[model samples]
Target: MKDKKPRVAIQGIRASFHEEAAFIHFGEDIQTIECSSFKQTFEALQNKEADYVVMAIENSIAGSILPNYSLMMSYNFPVVGEVYLPIQLHLLALPGVKFEDVKYVTSHPIAIRQCIDFFDEYPHLKVVESSDTAACAKRIREEELTDTVAIANTLAAKLYGLDIMERRIESNKKNFTRFLILTHHENVEKKDIDKASLCFQVSNQVGALAKVLQIFAEQNINMSKIQSMPVLGKRNEYNFYVDVEWDNTKQYDTAIRQVLKYTHNFNILGEYQRHEDEFVQNEREQKFRAQEKITRKYINVKKIVK
Candidate 1:
């Protein structure tokens, strides 16, 4: 007998980047519950409508997703793992529609911003901001808008049956997004822990934050990320969110003890294994390369019969 697949909730439709990250983490065995927004994604998890939630935390080009950090502080969900997914934006439109046919381009504002350089060459095309990248693609297909194109991932294009007019159209080729796998606090396990997401606040004094960081340095714990979010309704006060990595559990435990002495409202959000980038890339790229290899074999056929 086999175990039942987990139901993962994501913000957007089937072909969004969140869904892509979920598949990367859980493989193709899990079921996805699409939520309209990040808040809805958390609500689905809180209501037990999903076994886990895939949330994008940050992007290399856009920096931190501050809203998501705020959501994590409010929900206090356990961060079980993370996945860094490379983003590839494409220009997609209805079949047989050429570049001359496009009058407007629609996508999420962030997606539009990433391709600003490309759009500069074609000043005639109007860029319209939309809710979600995949949603924009969906709109074009459902409304039969032949004059508008979408800027989205290849997955969205394939899902909406849109032809990709251009590939890798993003201004920066190094764009990647980091997504967090979240679960209820009680369900979180400390086994195989190497990376942790923590939140705390230091007393409003000079050198206070530096002392907390020094403790991590002394204990041999590496600080991978540190972001500060303002404490709501508090003037000039903030809550710091930090991600740390450690090779030894004992070192992390000792560091926490020292860190606690200098911080306020300290919270161990979650401690989980640091997902390797190579593993995710190998699994994802292999499938893509295999398909491409098959296509190339037919297109460039010169068999050797020795």
Candidate 2:
């Protein structure tokens, strides 16, 4: 019998970054199920409507997607793979539309924020926020809004039959969104795995957090990223999410055993093959030493913050 194409669920319509990441990881031969929200994507997996989900976990400029982290914890899906999609925002408009004809611009709020510097030059143009970037472009095409342009990607421009008025419109050209490929079933590929993600809580005592990190350091494990989030209803307590990498499988095993000694409410999120080499990872990092930047503050956070 011929095999059924893998049904992959994404958080936005086709041509959105989520769909791009899905195709990047699973190949274009698979079927994509569009979801209106992140929760819907997870529900699709839970309901067996999709074999896997491609969800963005973090951005280089915006940082980690906290809600998706909560979703990760809530669903307990196995992250079997990861793909990094470069966020290249663009000004998409209908054919023959000019910047002077634009009365308003719209996109996902996050996408708008990334292009703040671009809009700062043209205060006359009103900014409208929407749920999805690709949807904004789709709406402009479907409705033929000649006076409005959408801040989306080239894929959206192509799919919507719109023209790109401005390319690479993001504030930081080095921005990238790290997406995790999750599945309902566990993948036991220990020999091929080199990286893992986990969330754990350490005691308030001195060196509580240090002890767990020390174990990883001693075991020669490379910690790629670490972020903290307050434990809901637990005053002064926080949960730490970490991504660690190792060259030797034995080293990672030893580190996990050692980590369990000094942590509580610990959960191994996923173990999968590392996506890129050290050089590619280094290239993704932004260097701020020579450049001036504004301070970013987090006013409020949910139980899961990354």
Candidate 3:
């Protein structure tokens, strides 16, 4: 019997950005489990309904998705990998639909925000926030809504047979979203591991946070990202989420050991090789497979379960 494809849970319908990121990381050989919300994506993992989950943690233009941070802390799942997908929002509608026919535009709230500049031009069009960008496109196709348009990715426009009324409608063309790939099992330590995500809380005192930064500098670790969220059920206390990249694993180990002394509720979320390295490895693998004449299949069309 042939081996079953791995099931990947993503917080949107197929052809969504999360699905795009999953395919970019895991290849199209895997099966996608569509989820309506981010919470449901994590729950699918916990329920063992999926082998992996792709979740958007942050977008360059809108900043962090704060609720995901809390979910990560609650679930304590290991982030095995990350993928950065450049967002290109397009105004999609039925083939015969024109700009004047678009009475309502729908998409995920964040996506709607990204296309604010385009919407500002046509103030007459009402904006509606939906649960997913691709879902909006799927709805338009399923319902054959000629008066409604969707701001979604090019993949969605293609999948749902919608025509792009306006291309690259996002306010910022460089917009990109960072998605963290999560798994239930502990990630195997790799020699090429260079990046780590961690969360911790420090006592509320002057210079307490600076002390941790000083330790990182002394150990020569590069602090790539830092975000703070209010600790639940605590007053004025914040939990820090940080991403650090290191040149030497031993240096990172030493810095984290010293950091633990000053930090409470410390957690190393994940230690994994950076996405750049993963891309390079995948390139090598693809080349090798090409030389060996191995065939790979891809799934371009998928059904909307809704």
Considering lDDT, where higher is better, how would the candidates rank from best to worst?
1, 3, 2
Q: Residue by residue across 61-160, what tens digits does model 3's lDDT show?
A: 8889999998998888898888878888889999999888779999999998888888889999999998899999999999999999999988998999
Off by over 4 Å in 1: 279-306
lDDT of 2 by residue, 1-306 (tens): 028888999998988999888888878888889999999999999999988999998988888899888899999998888887888999999999988999999998889889989999999999999989999999999999999999998889999999999999899987888999899764334448888998999999999998999999999998889989998899989989999988888988998998898899999888998777343567535432222232232323332384
- For all candidates in order, the CA lDDT equals 0.89, 0.87, 0.88
lDDT of 1 at 99: 88
* Global lDDT of model 1: 0.89
TM-score of each: 0.88, 0.89, 0.87
RMSD of each: 11.3, 9.0, 13.0
In angstroms, how far off is 255's CA in candidate 2? Answer: 0.6
Can you tell me which runs of candidate 2 are displaced by over 4 Å? 186-191, 277-306
Name the regions of candidate 3 deviating beyond 4 angstroms. 1-3, 186-191, 277-306
Task: Please report, as a residue range, the 10-residue window in candidate 2 with the lowest summed lDDT.
Answer: 288-297
lDDT by residue (1-306, candidate 1, tens digit) is 037878899998888888999998989888899999999999999998988999999888888989998888889888999999888999989989988888999988888888889989888999899888999999999999989999999889889999999999999987888999998776677788899999999989999999999999999898989999889999879999999989988999999998889998999888899887864567558876998999888667755331
Best model per TM-score = 2
Q: List the residue pairs that clash in candidate 1.
A: none
